[model samples]
Target: VTLSDLDPPNAYRISGEGSGGVAGYAKGGALVRLESESADVTVLHYDVDAQIGGKLAQLGARLINSTATKLAGEFFKSFADVVSAKAEAS
Candidate 1:
């Protein structure tokens, strides 16, 4: 993936083309933004998109969509855990 259009402490975008095996059958991107809500809280807004082709697409939209959703959830949860740990360390 390539990281671009970055605005530190606020927003960034990540985009990339598919490469190799099952990955070669798909391409995806994400946009993530952070908005401060209060002294101790911040809100994260994200948009994700994916396009699938080849044999992978034959797996049906329901399966593919659910897998993507699960991955995204795990990603954000892991991100939050890391950030929380860093804040505590600071």
Candidate 2:
């Protein structure tokens, strides 16, 4: 993942590309927004596109989407737990 853009302390967009269990390669980006003076972070958008020619022609879209969704959920769960632990420590 790479940080494509940032707006001070409130917003940012990231871009990344990789291959997964579904067969071929994919590219996507996300827009993240942060609440002021708070720990809340939201993903406003997550978009995926075929790396070859911008279409999920052969590599089933549902399968790839499901995998990405599952991974994102796991990541957020771990991330939130870490943040909570740090807050408790502080």
Candidate 3:
């Protein structure tokens, strides 16, 4: 994995590649940007690209996609909760 093209307090890009037994091999990258909507609101935008190969790709792409989507949703929800808590504490 690699983290680069950082724009402090605003954006960044991440990329990685790996291989496993059941999961096979995969490579992907994401560009994440933060945009200020208001004094107290910031919106995050992300673009991701991934390629799956070998057994995993041949097995079930739908299942893999849905799981990834679910995980991303959960991650953002948790992130929002933490951010809100910190703002309230401040």
Tens-place lDDT per residue, model 2, 8-88, is: 666777778866544556776656665544454433333433232234536567776677667766765687788778867
Q: Give the poorly placed runs of model 1, Cα more than 4 Å off.
A: 20-24
Candidates' TM-scores? Answer: 0.78, 0.65, 0.80
Q: What's the alpha carbon RMSD for model 1?
A: 2.4
lDDT of 1 at 87: 84
Q: Residue 67 lDDT in model 3? A: 71
Cα lDDT listed for each candidate: 0.79, 0.61, 0.81
- Deviating ranges (above 4 Å) for candidate 2: 19-24, 37-57
Q: Which ranges in model 3 have alpha carbons more than 4 Å from their true place?
A: 21-23
Top-TM-score candidate index: 3
- Residue 69, model 2: lDDT of 67
**Each prediction's Cα RMSD?**
2.4, 4.7, 2.0
The better-scoring model by lDDT among 2 and 3 is 3
Clashes of each: 0, 0, 0
In terms of lDDT, the poorest run of 10 residues in model 1 is 17-26
The deviation in Å at residue 52 for candidate 3 is: 0.7
Best by lDDT: 3
